[model samples]
Target: MFEKLSYLQLQQYWWFLVGTLAALFVFMTFVQGGQTLLRELGRSETQRDLLVNALGRKWELGFTSLVMFGGALFAAFPLFYSVSFGGAYFVWMAILFCFIIQAVAYEYRKKPDNFLGQRTYEIFLFINGSLGIFLVGAALATLFSGGHFVVNEMHLSRWTNPLYGLEALANPFNIAFGLMLFFLSRLLASLFFINEIDDEAIYARARKSLLRCTLMFLAAFAYVAYAIATMKGYGYDPATGAVFAKEGKYLQNLLAMPAVAGMLLAGVLGLLAGVAMTLWGGSRRGIWPAGIGVVLVVLALFLTLGYNDTAFYPSLSDPQSSLTIQNSSGSRYTLVAMSYVSLMVPFVLGYIAFVWRAMSAKRLTVEEVENDPHHY
Candidate 1:
């Protein structure tokens, strides 16, 4: 059935798959967000343990989805993998380190007589929660904002800035997006806590955090939206396969394609609505609506970056090095093969859903953490 479609169809399919996985990963980062706020949310040792255990129950899902997201992007679009991964090594390394520490911190934080004290491990978790999500979001922002790398004639990439991946900080717009992710993660964390943690103190604090983070999220998001919509964008000449700068390209893309525009608007509204409902209604189940809203918004953002012949990853050092979905994707045969494997994605998602349901079937309380034999 898939063989009948053209190669371009396969590439688009893979892009969509990658986008979907990315959306899922973003939603899962709520675990990281919640971890970052452990100190603020928990006043007592028992309460802290409760928060850690609640977050611990699902941190692996975020990590696994992140790894899978990278792998899928590598298989589907080798050039982006090579260019971004190669050029942005510093930022990538930092994110990797953060995640590694997260896994270790969770495993040994509660272990008896661990070399590092529990406080130290908890700090590590906070680092992962804040810096990990922020840096990753910034790195992704480079997809639309371009980066400091030049691709040689042979397609070898060279970093133009001495700061390496950290150069992304120089772009205010990128930082804006990064801040948006950080705050959004925190917001989601609050919603999750409201649903998962039953302690009144923690629940009230989570609500407050959600409200504050939502404000920050909106501020950063508005900045990014304004910048992206008005800024000059990298456009590819599909006929020549050459990339060049075009003014208001993103806005044009939104205007030219009604479906994409509709998705963008819907995603934004969904995200806002979710946050509002959680904040105003004192809803315990805000996580569901907010989580789904994040997925939609992120998916729409990714589609805007990749579709419409835009350079998803533009090279600031050399214009010719810019990469579009058409040029950076793997060979048609490889894409087709991967497309077949993608069929199992539903099963994987189903398994994750089942695990999530079983885990969250009962709300987590301090008493449960103290009494449960399987406490993390």
Candidate 2:
């Protein structure tokens, strides 16, 4: 079946897979969002333990999603992986450092007499939740906003700015998207806590936090939506392989692809419905709807950037260096091999769902954390 399709088909297929993994990673960031609320939602040590353990059960999944996202990109679009990850080393390094601390914090937060102390570890989780997510959003924004890098004939890439990818911070659109993701994560986390934790105080606080985070998320999301709709996007000519800027490119993409626009609408409505259910209907199952909405929304965003002959990774330093799915993809042979490997994805997701269900079958309580020997 794989051998039957053209190379472009395979490239698009892998790009879709990469986008799906990225969407899942964004949804999983509810873990990061939950981390930021540990102090706000959990007022006591026992309550904090409940939050920590609840999140710890799923933090690794978010991290794994991130790794898989990177790996898929590296395999399917090595040029993009090298250009973005290599040229923007500082930003990527900071993100890596944040996740490293997150893993360490989760492992040793409850260890007997740890050297850094519990407060320090908690702080690490906060850093990962806020700074880590913000930077990732900014990094992804470069896909639309363009980055300061040049690619040579030999395919070598160099960063034009001294700040590396940190220059993305200068763009308000980037910051808006970053904050949007951060708050969305928080909102999802609150819904998750409401569903996963059996404590009254945590549930009440999570409900309130959901409202606040929803407002913040809406503000940031509105700004990003406006920016993307109005901004000039990099356009690629499939016939000549030329790159140029087109006004209202993203909005046009939405108009051109009604199915994707429908997805965006459905995702937004689902997200709003999830929040409303949690806020007014007192539904604990809000996380499921909200999480699925997040994945759909993110997947739609990625499709917008990659489809419509748009340059998914644009180079500000050299317009010709902009990367489209065709230019940045691996060889056809590699993609075919990877496509076969991709068949395992459904089974892997099913197994993860099974494990997640088994683990979450019982809600976390003060008693479980105090009694369980394996508690984080």
Error of 2 at 21 (Å): 0.5
Alpha-carbon lDDT of model 1: 0.87
For each candidate, what TM-score against the reference?
0.97, 0.99
lDDT of each: 0.87, 0.93
lDDT (Cα, tens digit) per residue for candidate 2, span 347-371: 9999999999999997888998899
Off by over 4 Å in 1: none
| Model 1 lDDT per residue over 142-190, tens place | 9888988887767677888887889898889889988989998999898
Superposed Cα RMSD, model 2: 0.8
